[model samples]
Target chain A: MRPILISCHTRPVIAVKFNKDGDLFFTGSFDGKVSVFWSEPVERLGTFACDGAVKTMTVTEDSKYIVIGTAINGIFIFEVETGTKVKTIEFSSKIHVRDVEFAMGSQQFFMISYESDEKKQSVVYIYDFESVLNREQPSRRDLVRRDRDHYYRGVWGYLNKTIVLGTQNGIIDVVDTKTGELLLSHRAHVNQITSLAFSPDFSMLITASRDCFAKLLDPETLKEIRVFNAQRPLNSAVISPLMLNEGSPKYHCLVAGGQEARDVTTTATDQGGFEITFYNMIFEREIGSVRGHFGPVHSVAVHPRGHMFVTGSEDGTARVHILDQDYFTPAYD
Target chain B: MADADYIEREHIEATADGTYKITTHIKIQNKTVITNPDIERRKTLPKFGDCKNLSKGDIEGSINIEDKEVFLQKSSQVRAEENITKFNLNRAHKEKLDALTRRERAIMSGETEEQKTRRPIVTEREEFSVKVSNLPDNIDQDVLQNLFGTAGRVRKVFIPRGRDDNLPRDFAFVHFDTKAEAEKAIKQFKDYPLGHHILSVEMADRRNQRRNVPMSNRRGRK
Candidate 1:
């Protein structure tokens, strides 16, 4: 399938996410802007600006508000429709927010921040989403803290009772938000876990690590279910919603990453693995790959309906690919 | 044969390109005509030839004028003698040509009898060297010599480094005084824990000396 190339960010794009309805998608970049685009026609709708380079961002379940985390140790909330700033939360100058996500079905959200110091401290904070939306002081609390290994990504489990965090040491930690207790910790890979994603049904959690492995695990118990191995380090992985459908479904997963940015200058583009790879989720075999990005792909987000997916890359572009009809058939198996 | 009424007409004309165009027309009164019974009967009759009364084998034997066994035996005797002479001549010529080509090939490839019999010189240091790999990056030659000196009398220690960065690689070679001492060092240092990594020691294989050269100097030659 040919992808619709959306190039607006002036710097490398770090994150791309789709709304719950899959009608609109957003791309966050180091240029300090989050541009929203229509998923079907792939037209730029509007852009929200912040004061610092965007590290990560997440939209509310209703697609009404967006929370952006920036490298300047600030978290900015904006109303999606008007592109108006709603709230701004600042941290110490040395602390930069890495990831943020909304709770499954509540007025709460979580943010993972890391300190740029020798200790490499990481802390996860939970905020009351409604208060932030009202431009009031949001009730916040530290849910988890680490001094050695940094937490790169985190996602709420099931119904927000548990939060699954992926750490720098390839460890997946499941923490209870109410008690702030560590429930389970499992070493998911051999290197740092770069991203964490949950399947559409929230039954399985997929973790992408710098060790060139993406694994599916039971979110509650942290038990390994399946493993997808690649040649280069994987930055992001997403499971197709069609894989869990009641009708005829395709068991496919999308994984995107490439060689490290530092070594890209000395490596050839093709050999650097600058493409999104498709793997058979059940068989754990690579089916095919889509090549377009000139640099490493940093993030990939699939539509809720599984018909389209968007990839953000270090090439400063986000490509939206609407899957062809032939993808629905089980040809890879 | 049946007689039928027919009319025939012809028209000729000269036109462009200096070519003649002719048109012939025929009109038949009867749609069908009967064939001659006598001719049909003649066609159905069996054919008669000179060997009509002879059997199949008799006809074949008459056509073959020579005696089969005698002709085959005589031809075989002649061909066998010819093949013997040809085979001997070809064998002698091939042997001579093979030797000539072998000598030419050896000369082309710069291979002589002396070159084939000669062996490469091996120094005592190379024969008594042991390669230690998986060493810590911060390790130095002095530390390596001190660590390996317990096995035997250490002659020399060398650590390879990166050409561009000049940082030491993860391996080093230690030369002992004798082969037995080298073997003792290999046995003793195998899997020896140094820093956080285990050391792997083995006899140095000097067959490919290219690996011992620096990267920048080794390029463009092979």
Candidate 2:
């Protein structure tokens, strides 16, 4: 069969995340649909859509099942092959969710809920699926919900121990993934916190948002190490997970893409368009700009190994580009 | 414009290379208009062909889509004429109509009206148009001759086809030689009781008066 066009009336796909082996990728659309596209051989045209457009997808460190946080419809865990809808968690009390992720190397997962009940009364729920992974009888314990009005959007796990979450009101909460204990919560950005990603080493953390800047923060001290003013409001920034692989010796840069036009309606005419700027992850200064797409460049994914990676757009095309170090090349440094 | 409201197509002509002449005379009528190959279906129905023996337009200075009053007046005469089922093919058509109407839903599904050619009929006649909407999409001239041939002597059955899309129009217009025979067809098929599709029959417009629509709206009418 040919690829048929499918569109969700709500939102265009904003973020798509592939599982560890890249066999399945979860796509989250603005339409509140978080769908999984699984390719038996990781091939195109073999891609099939799951029921919803998921915003983000994270796999357990062992690459077993994926946990995706959705809008309105709640979170869904898919078994992938036979489309077995393994587990679903919903607070249904009109709690909207912005981001979802699982703990590093842990079978359990964490979800962030919105301030639905009260004007600012909010909570983040962590559902433990340790038994599901252990195969006790195909089920796990119910979720442990945390009420925190300060926590907002981004969440991640690092070093198989620390859980890092960024909130909508510009706060970053660092919690212990093992005990579900809150470790650190700091206002990282000046505006709404868009996303957070930890360097593969788990030592350095990155956050960006409508504040028009991307900052590298030390997860331990909760202090901004370096601040770089991006050309546009940064939506998302991701560092390569396999940075410095094979001991290439090049400075693995922290690259970010941001929206220039600033508005959605007149996105078509913006010539300089959206900018994908690169920076040395450690030194943190503007390196260069990558251009082409016409709308808000929303998300970035550094490919696992090679210098090639992709960035998604509101203009409807996700661009994959080749990036290598510059100024002080690997040979010079 | 009111006088020229309804028109039907008789035929189209072209030059040797299939190009048409500058100005062609068309036949037009409402009640009992006479038309043959020579005139156009229009306001000024020229005096020509089988139409030579009668006045050009109806005495009411009007044309009705269906002459129900006329059909009512001559209904008995038509029924008596239908009793003469000359050709066996027509008897077969009658049987088919019976079969189709019995299977109601089947006619509605998988059966589409040929967008191009409807059974030929005078326009604005609900009885004529609606009945044709019910018939089989692809009935040819022979089948029509058999089906409607009961009312009178079937001289010709014209199924107008679209020049482009080629979708068949569901109705077929049939002409008979005599007024009594034409009236007989109107009486028999006017209600279109068979096959869920009953056809409407009427005195054919003289060839010039055969108009499917207004000259401006009608294709091939420069």
lDDT of 2 at A215: 77
Q: Candidate 1: global Cα-lDDT?
A: 0.77
Give the chain B TM-score for each candidate. Answer: 0.42, 0.32
What shift in Å separates residue B45 of candidate 2 from its native position after superposition? 75
lDDT by residue (tens digit), candidate 1, A104-146: 8648989898888777789899999877766567788998889
Q: After superposition, how far is residue B193 of candidate 2 from its true place, in Å?
A: 99
Best by TM-score: 1
Per-residue lDDT of A240 in model 2 = 61
DockQ in order? 0.01, 0.00
Give the alpha carbon lDDT tens digit for every residue of B1-222 in model 1.
132454545566767777675655455655687874533442232312222353322322211212211100112353355566655654553465456556547766999867544434444334467888999877877898888889999987877777678778898888777889998998898899999999999888764433574452454244
Cα miss at A174, model 1 (Å)?
Answer: 0.6
Interface RMSD of each: 43.3, 38.8
